[model samples]
Target: MAHDTGSSLTRIFAPAKPPAGAKAGTVGEAADAKPPVVVSLSASAPAAPAPAGAPAAKSFAEVTTDARAALDANLARMKESGRTLGMGANQGSQADIDAAFQGMDRRSLHAIASNSGGLFSKDEQAFAQTVMSQQLVEATGMDDPAGFQRDPARGFLAGVRFLDTVSAEEKASDNWRLNRAVAQTNYESSMTRDHPGEKAENVDSGDPVVNFLAQTIRSKEGTWTSVHDGSYVDDLSRITLFKDGTDASGLQKARQGAGTATRDAAARIDITL
Candidate 1:
């Protein structure tokens, strides 16, 4: 995102302001003292609707057979990957299952996606995101209240703002360089050839997700006029695009390519905020 030199929102860093207090790592300590309560998490798409006119199986035998077949397929997939069934990551392990609902009412957590205690709850569902979101952070196998307050996204956004607020002297250090690699990859790109009648053109999205894509072309350009010309506030327009529901479709729209409007100055202040 190498852009021309006159950018306000897009920059090497943001203006500095001393924190109201020291960098408080005390969130963890204070969280430990609070009894874990059931919370609802709505960070992603909502539950899928049940199939229309699809009747339940006639008996327990059918249910058993279906479950067994599903497990067999999962096992086969594991075998192909050479991964142990109980291995780490988001693999649906019994241990992972146990920790996902940790510190909350067991029965309540069990009714996830179907009830108020589902993933949207502040209880078990939210806790699961922390343990499973990172590779280095192991599944504690203990569902406790302390991990709940350490909201990963908040921590990340806090760090982002903090980095923006730091002096250039602090930003150029070794610590910040490594942190750059940790930024999530959410960009998408590709080459395409069309029929004779179709126009050929390049598609570059200034969308936030596209900017942070995991699989990307990895261009060297920084936030610039030709790269992502729009202001940083363009992200709010993406958010505004999906104000109705948090369904899969909504998520897709909310994360659509922002490149088309990346240079449109009018879009910056267009959202509800």
Candidate 2:
């Protein structure tokens, strides 16, 4: 499938004002001061109507098989690129990795990286972590609701770290970074439904899933620009995808090609066996 490069959105998160009695410039204060701004990256292409005599949607088993194949192929490519699939920094043993993989669904695998605390020792493992984390968070809420509320920033920072550590090569080819972002956005969207009347406005985007993806793409592009422009130092310490409100800067549109490619590949799987 041809990749689309121009389909990205841009969003800006303006700094928030400090709460009353809080010291100016404290981390919490600064975070509280930022307001999120979301702009549409691109209008979503309308879903095409099924063609006459188009094959039925693949069964869940077929879909799962196809996903596994894509994952295996991607993993092989990563291995060829000198990436290692070994234990992460904090993982105790190969058994740990194996156990983690056992009985886990693709989404769970996708969500692993984000929840792994950034302890991966190799790029391939990091990629795996993202895939696993994406899956896991979507299946499960972003941790317990109370815990998430207590420190939502932690989850957001972990996501940023995953994106930041993605190899440029992987980002360009596998599009894992974009996929991870999309997955996280989807998770956040689900979280909004799970909790009512709690900073609902703060997290509001026309569509949380799409907006979250758009915001992530913008944040990544901004980081790259800031690094090269010499106007601001690149810092990943306080990464935030949501602020006063969320905004998009057109990155999501550019990355949609990758997402489409993934879906198409899975949809084409032959499950006659």
Candidate 3:
């Protein structure tokens, strides 16, 4: 018998094709024969690209950090130029501070205001308070921007004297109502409760309520006998009007007054009142 070496070798090396009815990828006549498995060792698919012209959004923490850094840089620049904030021999102008504040947004200002760290000086703290207060008025069109008073001596804290009355939640609150309430209460207490030695009339509490009441009463004193007769003692005594708090009788009147004031303030700024 003559051996066909080439054909024999081909038969041995290459697998035999499955019989006619067999499924694809299988070899031989056995019904149980499995196809050879293939696995890829290739790298993973690439991630999809971001949309065109859209920048990555920042987190609250990142925004706050950026705000603080910008504030520091601005202060540093001012210092380098031999100027400083607040009342001093070489005090920086309000324009300088306002320009620096342009880098910050409402959230950034909120974060800065909520901070209790010694990172900011009294004047810086005062500036932040003033700016935030104004922003609140501008944004919410609420009355009593002056309610958010600052001493530039002790900074605008959330409570009476040294005691912080506002909870952490309230301090962190974005709600304008809560902010106004806290500011107003703190201001009121600073005038009446905090200073016991001084007469309410003589004390310049930086409180808008007291100021408004006092000014209104004094201006009306010339016309209204009730104020001139000293029955209420002084214009500051009009704060008693708010003494009722949220009583049923007072609530509506209070709301009406607040609404009117808010509208007036917003009107002066030429915004929605």
Candidate 4:
């Protein structure tokens, strides 16, 4: 008798399909009993490409340009808000002032001046004029005589001499008021206050009078040395001799005036001294 291979045990242990072209009865019976389950695994679809001619992400240059534009707009708004941009409020030295005025053109100066509706107080105008004068001096090598009176380094004496000279000249001039006002403002702002033991020479003196005398002597001697040579005073020296004493220029001017007076006296009386 033929063995019955298509039994339940054969279906559990035998191959799922029969060999190619083999008699199908043996394995077909098993395959037909229970078919293999089919599983379909699909790969994910690729991402879509970006559209052509569309704007790309911004580069570093574009980003930087945008930031700079915003900054400039903010500065323009501040300027329109009636603020002083470069008027030297924080500047304490001539060098600092000069640096602030650097790269400033006439248009820029006008803009800065008119930022507050073109209305400036006397002090404001004076300060503006001082800045302009400094620029002019730097560019043309011409000194503003009034500026020397306002220079702190020229000391107190130079300031007084400058005031005296300007005062006498202004008496004959029609613009006396304006000149006097500017000069007075500059003098007041530039005057140095003396303190006890401020200078090296004043440190050893116990009495105030003695200290004053000693300071005076030191100032005079310094001024004289700065102006005087062995034979005569140097006419072209620019060194300031005193903050409270006569400078080289003032001494020269005094000498000239004295010589004129002496000559006039001699012409009348023929007197020798």
* Cα TM-score of candidate 2: 0.24
lDDT of 4 by residue, 1-273 (tens): 111211311221122232222221222232332221111110121223458987874543443344334334533654576533333342223332233334433223322322223344333333333442222222211133244224432332232233233212222221222122222322232232323233312122122222232343344432322321211111223223233344444444544554575568678775554
Quick one: ranking by lDDT, best first?
A: 3, 2, 4, 1
Better of 1 and 2 by lDDT: 2
> Which candidate, 2 or 3, has the higher TM-score?
3
| Cα RMSD for candidates in order | 20.0, 19.6, 35.6, 44.5
TM-scores, all models, native as reference: 0.19, 0.24, 0.33, 0.18
**Model 3 Cα lDDT, one tens digit per residue, 159-255:** 2221122222323232322233333333434444445575433233333333344343333322222321211111222333334342334434444
Q: Cα deviation in Å at residue 171, candidate 1?
A: 29
- Give per-residue lDDT, candidate 4, residue 119: 40
Task: For candidate 4, give the lDDT of residue 79.
Answer: 59
In model 4, the worst 10-residue window by lDDT is: 36-45
User: Quick one: best lDDT, which candidate?
Assistant: 3
Ranking by TM-score: 3, 2, 1, 4
Per-residue lDDT tens digits of candidate 2, residues 1-273? 111111111111111221122222212222333211111111122225579999986544454454455545544664687643443332222222332344444333333322223332343344344323322222222323344345444444343334434322334322343334543443344345444454432332223233445465444542322211111111222224323233323334434654675566567775432
lDDT of each: 0.28, 0.34, 0.37, 0.30
**How many angstroms is residue 229 displaced in model 3 relative to the true structure, after the best TM-score fit?**
26
